[model samples]
Target: MNLKYLIFIIILITGITLAEETKQKAVLVTGASSGIGLKVTEYLIKSGFYVYAGARKEEDLKRLDAMKNTTSVRLDVTVQSDIDAAVKFVQSQNRGLFGIVNNAGVGVFGKMSEVPDKDILWIHDVNVMGPHRVNRAFIPLLKESMGRTTIIGSISGYVTSAESGAYSMSKFAVEAYTESLADDLRETGIHVGIVDPGAYKSKIRAKVTMFNLTGSYDLNQELTEEQKKVLNAAKERNNKLKEPDEVAEAVIHLMTSDKPKLRYMVAPTIGAAEVTMKTTLGRVVQLNADQQFEYTRDELVAFLDELLKENSSEL
Candidate 1:
């Protein structure tokens, strides 16, 4: 054989070996019933990785189970027993878990004053503690694989909108906790990262609005008709969000890359928001710290006058 041909054959063999190594890797994705989690699971499976998709509903699990190269396990991140069962299912697969995508969480939108304590606690349970429970349950498996565990957080993790305080608080907690976890696991060869996506077209916004806020309250009596209109406008803005697949693609990129980043802001909107929050406007707002006092000082007259003026300019 020619020497050139022999060298070519050797390079081809090395490439094949690397591809095989990548194919053997497996991943577990939580909250696979719908939205971003479901889409991410589908993308991973299509890329030829063994995927364990977890959902609280068996019907949804069965739907994902029907897909090729995928398995579904019943998992409610809020429950430890369910998490244990999910871990056991992955262990039984015999592929050795390569990644854990903590994608299960919910959103809540309401003023902290209007939202009940019970609702706030529920948000924290599902959004913050849920990921913590799953990470704890699957850390050993992730460590065994010696790869990475990607946490699917949100843009709210870094910035808070007016009505989404509860949800934002939960995501902020997730961000801090995961960052600390990443540092702690750096030496162990098990990487940790966060995917903070902006608004995605998902059931989350509608579901949160429907479930977290209901019934007539005495607080509503105090709220003027104009205040109600402003609240509805905010909800409408959220309804016009982007698709979940955008977020799924980002998750897949983070998972498959050789050198993953510690955090990824999923879309341009999030990137823009982050930039704005770091700019002069954010600094000015923080420095003043008297918007609330100024508004209440004159029955929100100045606030409403400025708001109407902006609306007129837009029109």
Candidate 2:
């Protein structure tokens, strides 16, 4: 080869090598249109990671795509075709996937005995099965990269309320799913975790209420006095809730940390944390109430102390 041509080739090869080395690890965040999902996406991009922000609405997709270091994917977690296309799009980018944040979920509130079966199924489809579908579709990519996957669970998984039976059931199912997934991938060098967020400012309640009353998230339709009261209560609670930045921080840690935890409860207040832990302990007491092989109080306390020490060491 001529001297000048050889030098040009060297420069081209060097450029390609640098590009490969400097490429940012990409993370897929479903339901990135708003709330916790959007917060997680923003945090990842700002932390110098690439984000494939998934949103169902075209306008939301445009907004996400406009953000720095983001490629908005039109992913409807409930839709298999959308998920398939999203997987293909990520593959075409040639940036191997590093993590997935299953954040797309819906809420439902009503007496379990009277709530329509369709409504219950709808909540499950999005809140429970959505993560299942997305994770299954992307597990191959995750395995190739030895990446992490985290589900956006809720404190509701630990404490079920009277009117939130459907929603709580879905979240509880997510807890089980995450644990099972972690076990399945334990030896594959792929980490799995769950982030359970307490009440935070978000449109989930509004969406669920409106959809349940009007068959869609449309407020144009007139609501009954009782329904109006429900909406007002949600608004009041939202006004007092904090932003989900802390939840996003936990997600970032799970993705980047050397020893990521299996469960993270991102409660806004200490009271919230206490309530969840108490509820979990209450369940243990209930299970032991009439059991033949129940542990004594001292034994249970010892077990808890040991687990706490183990967890603190990991941190």
Question: What do the candidate models score in CA lDDT, each in turn?
Answer: 0.77, 0.91
lDDT of 1 by residue, 1-315 (tens): 999999999999998987775567788888888778888988888777788888876678789889887888888888889888888877876778888888988776777678778778987898788888888888888888887887788777766767978888888898898899999998889988899887776556545544534433222344456666654665586668766777777777777887777777776475656563564345545655665553243544676578779766643
Clash pairs detected, candidate 1: 201-242
Count of backbone collisions in candidate 1: 1
Give one digit per residue, the lDDT tens place, for model 2 in 1-315: 899999999999999987964578999999999999999999998888999999988889999999998999999899999999999999998898999999998887888788789888988999889999999999999999999999999999998877889999999999999999999999989999999999999888777767766677654578899988887787677778899999999998999898899999999999999999999999999988878998999999999999999989988
Candidate 1, residue 283: how far the Cα is off, in Å = 6.6
Clashes found in each candidate (C-alpha, N, C closer than 3 A): 1, 0
How good is model 1 by TM-score? 0.73
| Best-fitting candidate, scored by TM-score | 2
List candidate 2 stretches off by more than 4 Å. 1-22, 218-233
Q: What is the Cα-based lDDT of residue 132 in candidate 1?
A: 86
